[model samples]
Target: MSQLNRVAWIVTVGSCLVAALILVLSGYTGYAGVTLAVAIAAAINLF
Candidate 1:
């Protein structure tokens, strides 16, 4: 894969992992909003 593609993949995975961690730590509340935002960001990067 190209460098840009690798970077995008990393960002998407990292963001999702962080969001999941945040959600888990917060008892599945509060930062639920971040999950959506991160998913949108990842989807945008796909193009």
Candidate 2:
């Protein structure tokens, strides 16, 4: 269960970062910032 939780958070962080990257590439800085914030939060939860 712990391992699964870790995996879920990792995937959440990874996907959020990827989405932020795509958003930045498309010039959506505001949305990208939000996604990046979410990624950071997920990373914090990870540890």
Candidate 3:
């Protein structure tokens, strides 16, 4: 993979981890939003 792709994956994983942590602390209410946001971010990096 290219350097940019590597960086993007790192950011995506980091954000997902952060989101998971937030969901854990805040409960399921945040789960859907965080998951959706992470999915969109990851999807964008695919192109």
Candidate 4:
């Protein structure tokens, strides 16, 4: 992949990780955390 694509993927993954961490730390668990993380990452990418 191109450098720009790689950077985008990195940002997406980083956003997902941060989202998941926030959810977990805020008392969300398991599927809820993963779903919220994916949703947050998808929203970020969409924008």
Give the poorly placed runs of model 1, Cα more than 4 Å off. Answer: 29-47
Model 3: residues >4 Å from true position, as ranges? 29-47
Sorted on TM-score, best first, the list reads 2, 4, 3, 1
Relative to the unseen true structure, what is the C-alpha lDDT of residue 34 in candidate 4, on a scale of 0 to 100?
A: 77
Give candidate 2's error at residue 29 in angstroms: 0.6
Q: Model 2 segments beyond 4 Å from truth?
A: none
RMSD list, candidates in order:
3.3, 1.1, 3.5, 5.6
Q: Write the per-residue lDDT of candidate 1 for residues 1-47, one digit (tens) a residue.
A: 58889687778867786887778787885566667567767766656
Candidate 3 CA-lDDT value:
0.72
**lDDT rank, highest first?**
2, 1, 3, 4
What's the lDDT for candidate 2? 0.96
lDDT by candidate, in order shown:
0.73, 0.96, 0.72, 0.69
The residue-by-residue lDDT of candidate 2 on 1-47, one tens digit each, is: 49999999999999999999999999999999999999999899888
* Model 4 misplacement above 4 A: 31-47
lDDT of 4: 0.69
Name the best candidate (by lDDT): 2
